[model samples]
Target: MVSSVLQWSIFMSIFSSICCLRRDYFITAEEHWWDYAPSKQNLITNDRTISDRLIQTTEYRIGSVYKKVKLKQFTDGSFRREIKPAPWMGYVGPTIKGETGDVLYVHFRNLASRPYGLHPHGVQYFKDSEGSLYMDGTSGRDKLDDTVPPGYTYTYRWSMLNTFAPTKDDENCVPVGYHPHVRSTKDIDTGVVGILLICKPGTLNPDNSRKDVDREFVLYADTVNETNSWLIDQSLNLCLNPQRCRQLFNQKNEAFITDTLMYSINGYIYGNLPDFPVYEGEKVAFYAMGLNLGLHVFGVQGQSFTFKRKRTHAVVFGIAWFQGLYMTTRNPGRWMIFCKVNYHFNRELYYRLSGMNTHCYSYCYNN
Candidate 1:
């Protein structure tokens, strides 16, 4: 019952923050090419999964690079200078931070070719601030917030309500995801999503950084169905056999479509995420978010973390479920962090995988 209440459960923490403040974030939806396997080689299984037929520039595959629409942050309304995200954040947008009673001002811009809007769950907003389009009995200017046209900017004001805030038993902070609702599922597949952290009083520094945590890692896992991407046509055009790729797409070929799925953690595949160092004994927190289809069992290779007073090495959740895991760095050396769902752990990035096995793409891995 407790698990079901928290839509996508956020993890454990410690606290500080006193005053209610207004936090503003300037965000833009931009189009660019994202390389899942940046190294062009599998790093998790030591490249054992690398096969000529399975990845990159082959007679059929376009490799790991794909055109995507990502939510990028800028300094302000001008949308000129871009704000860099954490090294390990991968493709996710900058984390928005605040305390209970604080108000959030999200200045969203649609710089991409298509229209987009910012819709967040677990927050309080009015009709004009609501970024999702629906028959809410609203019209004219009120509906503009539903989908900001390309080259337009919309401001969504969301309040961190006590009702939606972390429970008293919840350690320090809580997390929720914010993404576009213009096309909902299709928008997420296009790669525009970010995290929102709401904390108790005094839990965060003035800069919004956590006070007690020495290391923080936010990992979002999902099987990106390239078929749903708005850039699908563009991707097909870049394929080795454009006509064949288009045929597969038009026919809705299950085998060919499934082959384009990318099992990723922060938009990276096969242990290719950027390095985020954690020293021994440092207080570390791992926030894992799982989406789309398939159940995920997130496991830490060596150490165990505490969740809801339970000490375990893994946390399980499926679509629309998320977990907050925190652990001190104890076991040394490099370890692996991947979705422990049987074949997903083994055959996910195992390139030579043939046949019409659609389940193969439903799994993802990283180290």
Candidate 2:
């Protein structure tokens, strides 16, 4: 009987080793790789649902105002009406028109620092095809569509959109506010999901500056990922390219946390990239390296990182990033990087071949 028990234990050990060796290959035995691609399904809130209101009937209601402030001058001798963004918050819209339902397009700096929600004015004509519009200060990054860090050096632009229906409501839009799915509580400065635009009361044609604003700057938010199965960008690639960014998981079971790097600027969080192979209760350390545009390196002076668990599932590991000024002459500039790195799985090392987006949207924010 004792011999039989010993034999069973040995078999179990061998099975566990096999599982670890082929972890990534088998992690999705039940799901196909193409299943990770983005879906065309629109994300609408309960407020935008068919039952939310009269669907076939076009609604032309009076526009509402929450906070109205006007500024004709700035200390810098500018005729622009500029408003400062709140602490770490921002606001967009009113897309104001007078009582007649004309459209006014407005842009704000540091919108993440204000308190404006999506609001619609004028007579809105309902159509079968739906699309949504929102105010974003992060320029194109407001879409929250990319998997790369936001603080990177890139050419950025801001715009707004007024989508119709069935295609453009927030996936989680409710009566009071709308949620941009890509941003988690960790990324946002405020916990509130701001207001969403209902339809304006008319056919949505413009006359003058209001027309140009509507034509040039319709408030629009980028779509966010709806599945937990994959991230915004999940193209698997070799980590050897400095310009390539991708999501990866351990290829083995016994991996433990190894290193982390978190960098900050003026008390603002810039970036945090980690390396791993970590286990519970294990202490890992790393350096926070900063680089200027000139390629000069600066250490945090005297700071080494230690791991802390914020989630119940995965173990925290290491973080790292490169800080530098990259120069370009054109509107949309390209930055090049050189990196040589490989991965170690189950005592075997594997290198990535390339970094690619698993969805329809490539890393176009670089645009």
Candidate 1 deviant stretches above 4 angstroms: 1-19, 46-54, 348-367
Total backbone collisions for each predicted model: 8, 52
Per-candidate local distance difference test:
0.73, 0.20
Candidate 1 per-residue lDDT over residues 1-367, each given as its tens digit: 2332232133111111434677899998889988887777666565454322235765566667788988888888889999877657878877888888788899988889998898887787766777997787777667888999999998887878788888888868777788888778888888888888878877888777899897677878887887898888888777788887788789988767766777778887776776556666777776667666567677767667888658888778767665567887676655667677875675342121111112222222232
Clashing pairs in 1: 11-324, 16-201, 16-202, 16-203, 17-201, 17-202, 17-203, 56-63
In candidate 2 the C-alpha lDDT for residue 55 amounts to 17
State the lDDT of candidate 2 residue by residue for 40-155, as single tens digits: 11111223332111111112100011111111112122224333322111122122222122222221112222222221211231110011233433233233222222222111
On lDDT, the leading prediction is 1
| Ten-residue stretch with the least lDDT total in model 1 | 349-358
Worst 10 residues of 2 by lDDT: 22-31
Cα lDDT of model 2 overall? Answer: 0.20
Candidate 2 deviant stretches above 4 angstroms: 1-80, 83-176, 179-182, 203-367
